[model samples]
Target: MSETTNVMNSEVVKRLLCYVSYDTQSKDESSEVPSTQKQFDLAKVLKKELEEIGASDVRLSDHCYVYAKIPSNLDKKVPAIGFIAHMDTSPALSGKDIKPQIIQNYDGGVIKLGESGFSMGPNEFPALAELKGKSLITTDGTTLLGADDKAGVAEIMTMAAFFLAHPEVKHGDICIAFTPDEEVGNGVEYFDVPGFGADFAYTVDGGSVGEIEYENFNAANLRVEVQGYGIHPGSAKGKMKNAIRMAMEFEQMLTVFDNPEYTDGYEGFHHLGGIEGDSDHTTMHYIVRDHDAGKLNQKLAEIDKASEYLNFKYGEGSFKVVRTGSYQNMKEMILPHMHLVEYAKEAMRELGLNAKSVPIRGGTDGARLSFMGLPCPNLCTGGANYHGRFEYACIEQMELCVEILKKIVEKYAVKEI
Candidate 1:
């Protein structure tokens, strides 16, 4: 790459630093689409920037979605594509006043985060060792870096601006969206898929630098309730049916060893994320996950059976489990049109990166959109440790991300049979 034509331009990096400053963490407990108004604060700014960059139909919707259409120049027929990234950060940690640590030419050892004991240690995260020679952007140990999707946003914005300035590139209509509440699972809830028309889309929200996911967990949120009859322990012996005890027992019936801490890599797990209980009433919250739909359904059934077994032992209606739909694997939506994945992979390879396809242990807006008649697969933003305090991203890898999006546009803009 020549000096003038090289990727990883300084303007993109500066824009990334500017984006990470916004605190847009979404609340899962909140019922609203954006979950927080702070997301809009960022969305408004992005819409203005998009307009300045010459994007057409740049609109920020009431639901806190920013959409822009980049027009095509070539006379040849090409499939319209969408590039998506989320604006909200994970609610797991604070995304406020993010202090990013920029490491230039990392040397493959323990790089302590700020003045704290937390570090990019090879002993702890061996993946850091793989990034020995790369430039890394990490948090300052006090707060999360919000790189989970912000890097994705920066990458998409950079590519969009690049294409707008260089109309000679001759790309097709490129649909770009920056969504809110992605961390809270409401990214595509109010999204107008038909409004922002595209043949397919790719979400820049996956981990690592080369991930391309079309499969994800068939998720279901579970709520278990236990009811017990209260009685005076001193006056009545064996009359006290403790609901808390029943609730604890209910949790015990499930395989505790199958927890997140004990699971990884395509292995399914039944995790109890939260629990609240007392002698008279008890409630437990869990999320069942599996890449295989059959296995996921089996886990949900097992949870119901566990509750039913307790109910049978204590009495009818003593304890019950309620299941609610969360998100489905996008593979069902993408399998029919697998070429989009191929396009993304070809783009990555053209930019000299690996084409690694993996199952998403979690969900994304793409997962929902894919089910909603859009074959969307997830792309990488060079981020890691998502939704956690230890979140970080490789700046050099983010540079690659921008280049990959450009190539995807280039590939589709001109195709020969």
Candidate 2:
């Protein structure tokens, strides 16, 4: 057996199982740094684990960010590298009381989730076919499996444990951080970039084993409000304008082909995520995304154009649009530092894995951190079908990710600063 395969088969998997048990789902409507206090529960567990593993300077911030470092044992100074992952799971579904089910030696066939009446097969998820004979961790269908990022957390923790256990292994300074509220997009709001003190960083928050991401969507949120004149039906005439009807009209103005269901692979879309309110007033929430900044601006302009036309028809101030910039594509920041990408690919290749550079259709904390001057890219965590109950993580693949991280660390150790 290989040395990588012999390093505690149960360690990474045990850590992952412990992490998903915490209810760390972030809230979007809450106006707080973490957006939810439950994130601190997991943060505290990670902080103690880091200290137990002999990581130096382990600190849990007041805002629920956990930071630590593994000091270099080398005589020469090398570039300090950081690995980051988020603590909070997506609020799209309930994350409370996640009961993860372990399937040993998957048969490359249909598998049923515990009592939740949900089942997955190789036909529906082709990725499962490739993972045959490997142990898989999945949810019970009552709640979402927190593998979206918990798999990442476990991998990093296991890597830290490995390096600390083997004193003979030489490497440079290794920085680690676990941020909160990434699911709600406020992940790096108060992140201490200078304090974390890494020359460059990577977020281990991507799906699949060999995926590497540097490009992401230029994203923005749009809020559309429509004010209508309301009156009793008996007394109502042409003066009574239905706000809900007008809101539907505004939605119809958007191109049908530009919706998420129809677009893929560099295609941009305007997704109407939520809508609320009744006759007198109506509000529609949309997230607009495009890899191209110019195209993103054009989509925003479409919203403005629609609002202007509605206001012209219904009188001034009757229709309004609020656009909020979220995060931009990290491609520009990473292009100047191609070594980060090349080194990651080399590490994966060294592990006999095919490295695939896939653009993130959504965003990660790395997307915002790159613009914040860290030039962060993203790495895979061996999980798939994120943000839903169908999520699962492969044990063997996650262990390989740990090996990949260790190889990258070795590469940077020899690299000239």
Best by lDDT: 2
Compared with the true structure, what per-residue lDDT tens digits does model 2 show for residues 1-417? Answer: 112333335788889989999999999877898899989999999999999989999999999999999999999988899999999999999999998888887889988888989999889999999999888888888889999899999999999999999989989999999999999889999999999989899999998888899999999988898998888878888778888999999999988889999999999999999999887899999999999999999988988898899899889988889875578999999999989999999999988899989999999899899999998999999999989988999888998999988999999999874
lDDT of 1 by residue, 1-417 (tens): 012223235666677788989889899778787899999989999999999999999999999999999987888778899999999998888999888887777888877788757766878788888998777778878788888789899999999999999887788999999999888778898998998878889998888877789888888888887888877778657777899888888888887766778877787788888888778788888889888888888888878889788888999989878774578878888988888888889888887788889988788889999888888899998888877667878877888889888888888887642
Q: For model 1, where is the 10-residue window of minimal lDDT?
A: 1-10
- Tell me each candidate's TM-score: 0.95, 0.97
Poorly placed runs, candidate 1 (over 4 Å): 1-9, 230-236
> Candidate 2: misplaced stretches above 4 Å?
1-9
Question: What pairs collide in candidate 2?
Answer: none
> Number of the top candidate by TM-score?
2
